[model samples]
Target: MSGERVAVVGVGQTEHRAVRTDVSMVGLIREAAKRALADADMTWTDIDAVVIGKAPDMFEGVVMPELFLADALGAAGKPMLRVHTAGSVGGSTAIVAAGLVQSGVHERVLTVAFEKQSESDAMWALTVPTPFQAPLVAGAGGYFAPIIRAYMQRADAPDDIGMMVAVKDRLNAIRNPYAHLKLPDIDMKTVEESPMLWEPLRYLETCPSSDGACAMVLASERVADAAAKPPAWVQGTAWRSEPTLFARRDQVNPQAGRDCAADVYQQAGITNPRADFDCAEVYVPFSWYEPMWLENLGFAEPGDGWKLTQSGATAFDGDIPWNPSGGVLSSNPIGASGMLRFAEAANQVRGAAGEHQVEGARRALGHAYGGGSQFFAMWVVGADKP
Candidate 1:
C-alpha cells in the first residue's frame, strides 16, 4: 500500500549488549515487541500486521527466522513481511510497517529488527567471498579503512577527529541506560591509546558485535490519538538503493544517501538540516563516519566537516546535536542499529529520552545506510503531528 502519512506511537529496545544469551532470536524480538505494545497501552491483539528485519542469515545461523518467530512475536495468522537491506534493514523495516498504516489498510502495526551476532562471528559472516573479489579483506573494518583514510586525506582532518567522535558518543552513552558498550571511562586519551584494529580505524572506532533487538509500534491518526503519550508524527521518510558495485559511486558520500536525505528534508520542508533538525540519530559504526556523514548530510562543506566535530557542534549541548542517544558507537547491534537510530529520534521527540533528551526538541532525524553505502534510509519525525 502507498503510505501517505504515518505516526510512530511507541518505541522500545532491549538492553543492547555484546551478548544477550538469556534469550533466543525469537525471544529477543518478542521482548522488544512486548515492551512497545505495553508502551502504547495496547496488547498484541491490537496490532494489525508485523514486519521483521535483520542484516543476514549468517550472523545468527538462522535463515528465515521470522517464519519461526511468528507465533513468538504474536504475529501468527497475520500479515508478516521481512526486509533485508544489509545494515539499513531496521530503518527500512519501520518505513514498510508505517506504510501499512498510512495506506489505511491497518490501524496499528508492529515492526522489529535484531541481530544475535553472538551465535556466529559477525566479522566472518560479513567477510563472505564473492566471485572475483580479493580475499585480503578482514571484515567491515577492512573495507572501510581505506575510505576513512581517504576522508582524512581529502578533508585534511586531524587524527583527533576520530578520538573526539568516540569519546563524545561514549560519554553520551552514559546518559543512555540501554547502550551496549558502557565504557564508563571512555575519553579521547583512552581512545587515542586504544589498540588499532584496522589502519586509520582504531579499536575504539569500531562498533561492538552485539546481540540485541529494537521494536516499534506505528499507529494511524486515530490510534495515535489514544496513545499513552504524545506520539512522534512521521513527518517524512525515504529509502534509496543503488547497485552494490557502480562506477563513480562516491563511497565516501554516495548519491543514494544524499538523495535519501534530500527526499526526507524536502518532505519535512527543511531548507537547512543543520539548523532545522534539533537532534539526529545517525548510524555511525565507525567514528570517522560522523564527519563523513556530516558532509554528506549537508551539515558542512565537503572538506570542513571535521571542524564541526572539533568545535563541539555535534555535542549534546551544541546548536545541532547528533546522536545524543550514544548512537551506533555506544550500542551497535548491526541489524538493530538502524532501528535504534529511528527509535531514538522518536524518543527524543516524545521526551522519553531521560538524560539524553534534547530539551524542547520539536524535530529530529533518524538515518542509516548499508551495502557498500548503496542503500540508504532516513526519516524526519516531529513532536507535533504533521
Candidate 2:
C-alpha cells in the first residue's frame, strides 16, 4: 500500500561518554532535540508530536522517565509516545516517528532516544536473575561469547577477524567527535593484546557503557519541500521480532533480522543491498556482529560475511561502506544506539556526515536489533525524495 512520503530533515546527537553528569536526563534529551530543531530551522511549536525511546528503565534507575520529560521536550500539550525494544528501541522509535508522517497523522515529528548508564549498572541490570533462566551467564559479553565461537567454528573464520573489526572501528571512531571510545593509537597489535574478557571476546572488543542521546526531525513531503537542508527521504522501513529463545532459534543469523531486511529491501526495490546502498550504519556493539549481521542482512551469503571484512570491503572508502560513524562499538548509549545508526544513515544521504562521509553517497541503510537477536528494525534512506 502506498503511504505519505517521509523525510528526515534534521539529525542531532550528544557527545557520547562514559558519564554525562553535567546534565540531567531531561537536559540531555533536550540538548539533542534543540540541535535537531535548529538544524530543521523549526521551533518546538512546529513539532506536531514527540516519540522517545531508551533501554529498560532499570538501566537508568528511573521509572517512566518520559513522563517527566514531556515538558522539556516541548510536548506539554501535544501527543507523546514512548518505545522500549531493548537495544533496538532507538531505531524502532524513529520508525514510529516516521509512521506518524507516513500515515498523515502528523506533519512533523520529533524522535529522541537516550541512556544515562552512569545512573545505574547496565551489566548488573542485564544480569538480574529471572525465573527459568540459567545463572551461569555473567554479562553481555559472556552470553554472546559462545555464539561468537559457534560462528567461528561454522565459518572456519580465523581468530583475528574480531580483532580486525575492533581495530578498524576504533580507527574510524577517531573521526567521529561524538564517539565515546576514541583510541587514536589503536591498532591490530593493541586489539590482539587486550585482555580477553569472555573467552573469544576481549575487553577492547566490547561496547562501552555510555551516556548520550540522539534526536531527529522527520517531516512529511509538504514540509520536507521547505526544509533548509537536503532531506534523507525514507524509502522503506520494516521491523520484526521473534521469541528470544526457542528450540529452533538461530542467534548467529537470526531469521527475524533476515526477514526485516528482506521486507525493507523489497519495499525499496533493492535487489542487492551491497550494491544498492552506498553505505550502511548497522548496530555492531560487538565487533563480530559486523560479519554476523552482514549475513543476516543479505549483504553476503551465509558464513561468507567475514570474507568481506577480511577484504576491507566494509571500510569507509570501500564499495559499500559500513558504520562510517564508528558504530556502537565506539559509542553505545543503549537506547540511543539504534537511533544513532538510523541518524547516521540520514546524515550520509544528506551529505552532512563531515569526516566520515561517504563521497557522493546517494543511498544508505540503517539497521538495529535487540533481545537475544529477536527484535529487528531497519530502514532505507536516499538523497532523492521517495
> Pick by lDDT: which candidate is best?
2
> Which residue pairs overlap in candidate 2's backbone?
none
lDDT tens digits by residue: candidate 2, 171-255: 8888898899999998888888999899898889989999999999999999999888999999999999999778999988888
- Residues 1-386, candidate 1: write the lDDT tens digits: 13556788888889987888798887888889888988888899888899998998899888788899989988888999999999899999988888888888898899999988898888888788888966537888888888899989989898889889999998899999888888888888788899998988889988888888999999998878877788999998899998766576688878888899888898888888898989999999999999999999989989988999999999998998989999988888898899999999998999888899999998999999986778998989998877
Q: Judge candidate 2 at residue 153 and give its lDDT.
A: 92
Highest TM-score model number: 2
Segments of candidate 1 deviating more than 4 angstroms: 1-4, 133-136
Estimated TM-score per prediction? Answer: 0.97, 0.98
